[model samples]
Target: MLLRDKFCLITGASKGIGKAISEIFAKEGAIIIATGRDLESLNLMVSDLPVYSAPHLVFKMDVTKEEDVLRVFNELSQNKIFIHCIVNNAGIMEDATLQMVKTDLIHKIYNTNVLGTILPSQNAIKHFLRNRCGSIINLSSIIGTKGNLGQSIYGSSKSAIIGFTKSLSKELAPLNIRVNAIAPGFIDTDMIKGMDQKFYEKNLKAIGMRRLGKPEDVAKVALFLASDLSEYVTGQIIGVDGGMII
Candidate 1:
């Protein structure tokens, strides 16, 4: 019950790592506000979360759209639901080599990965400032820190997240708010499920642990950052990458 009675908002919460985080947080007693583009999927996921004193909510949000992001915050405010934590877990990845990458693809990647994180965070910061206490957990990727082939656009977008997390953490620390980023490596998720078989096996060899990480593995680290356990920890990019970089 590390997050007992806390209200946590998780974006892109319909599937993969985001869904995993939602489940774990709910089990620990956090009232989850799960958002995603698919309303049906979000509702289905919410239906499965562990029950708590405060019921979980499902919102259809396209993280790339500022209007969508603002609407969710406004609606929550109208209902007097003050979120204690925000996990910017909404993102997309379409890996392409430099030559194969197109301008539209780059825009798509940045909008969802970079602007997606920033908009929700910008709105969350307003609420956090009033409370003078909050937590913001951003999801980065190991590919951002350690460059990879055929993923230039996707990697750069994640790198932007690292910068955003570091700067915001410093700005909010004095107010007792925390901002941290989790850079997970090659987790078993839909994002990586489409890789070529040989490419997939090659990635397996790159991990020191000799196994792909599970969504729950990343979720546990997120739980730490969202709870009192990480009160003294901020502005850090934690790698849930199974020593992939080492």
Candidate 2:
């Protein structure tokens, strides 16, 4: 049991990489608290999994709202379930250069991607500090580090996330609360499910693997970071991108 008797809170767990991580953690004997905007889809995930069907708590949360975040944390804490891991995976992308990006769009993206990471992490840190043992794995992106064109708003949000994770790692380390970030690249997801093949190929060629990454590929590394395996690792950005940058 890699995460024996642990409780993990995974945001954006209705689908994609978040869902993948939740499933992996649950199988590792960690009770999962899964959050997403869509309760129906989250419930569907719960029904589909064979891990007692209810180890995943479906939290209908809009990560942008601080009150909702604090409320959920309070509710979960009241149950006496000490959280051992927090995966901040909820984020949105506004694809456009800085000049072309709308102010409103920038606000929306930051609210979720940046502040979403902030508020929830604050709450998680509170619980983790009390226990003196925990892991916080934030979801950044290769876009944050490499700065791809037409991704200014999205990239900025993720870049900010990396800074936040690094600083928080320092602040929380004394309490034995480890913080880290995972930056995934070229993952095949529904958002780009219908993208043109030519564009994908052009992008895929950047990676040595010559293919798009799967959500599970990222989840495996996340499992490592979330468990005791990387307890000494903190304030780092790991690229699960098939050697794109290297």
Candidate 3:
């Protein structure tokens, strides 16, 4: 049990990669705090988590809203729940060409992807600084690194995450806190399922493994970062893209 008794807060935990990370962390003996915008889906997800001595908890958290993020953190403090790590997995993807992008759409994407990550991290980092130990695992994307045809806004937002991860890692490493980011490739999630069949097949051919990566694949890497296995690692951008970039 790599994370026995550890408390892990995973955002956007109702589906896809976030849900997979929450389940895997629970199976590894971590007490899970699963949060998302949808209370019902979050509840459903928590109900199925692997049981442990400390039952998994669920909260409706809109990571983009400062009030929502603060309220949850406050409640955790009130309950004396000290999290060992926080996975900033709450994010959204809206694709459009530069000319087709609207100002409102830009705000929407940045609000969810950029500010969404920062608010939770700001709260988590405060807690980590006080404890002198914690892990911050952020989700970036391979699209952010290798430019895609129709993902300028999404790519820039994820790229911001990579910058945040590196800067924060350096700032807190001296205090014994770690921060890192995972840039996953075209994962087989709702985001990818809606892709045109031709585009999907093209991606498969581009991937060295000739297959789309699974949510579990990203979750497994997340587990390593959350656990002691990555105690010495920080300020790194880990690519979970199955050799797609190589």
Per-candidate TM-scores read 0.98, 0.95, 0.97
Clashes of 3: 0
Best by lDDT: 1
**lDDT string, candidate 2, 96-122, tens digits:** 667887789999999999999988888
Which 10 successive residues of model 2 have the least lDDT summed? 47-56
Backbone clashes for every candidate come to 0, 0, 0
lDDT of 1 by residue, 15-96 (tens): 9999999999999999999999999999999999998798999999999999999999999988988889999999998977
Q: Write the per-residue lDDT of candidate 3 for residues 1-246, one digit (tens) a residue.
A: 989988899999999999999989999999999999999999998899888779999999998899999999999988888888999999998888999999999999999999999999889876776667999999999987787888999999999999999999999899889999999997989888777789778888889887889999999999999999999999999999988952
Off by over 4 Å in 2: 50-54, 194-197
Error of 1 at 178 (Å): 0.6
Worst window of 10 by summed lDDT in candidate 3: 123-132
Q: Let me know the TM-score candidate 1 reaches against the reference structure.
A: 0.98
Cα error, residue 160 of model 1, in Å, equals 0.3
- Candidate 1, poorest ten consecutive residues by summed lDDT: 124-133
Question: What is the C-alpha local distance difference test score of each model?
Answer: 0.93, 0.86, 0.91
Sort by lDDT, best first. Answer: 1, 3, 2
By TM-score, the better pick of 1 and 3 is 1
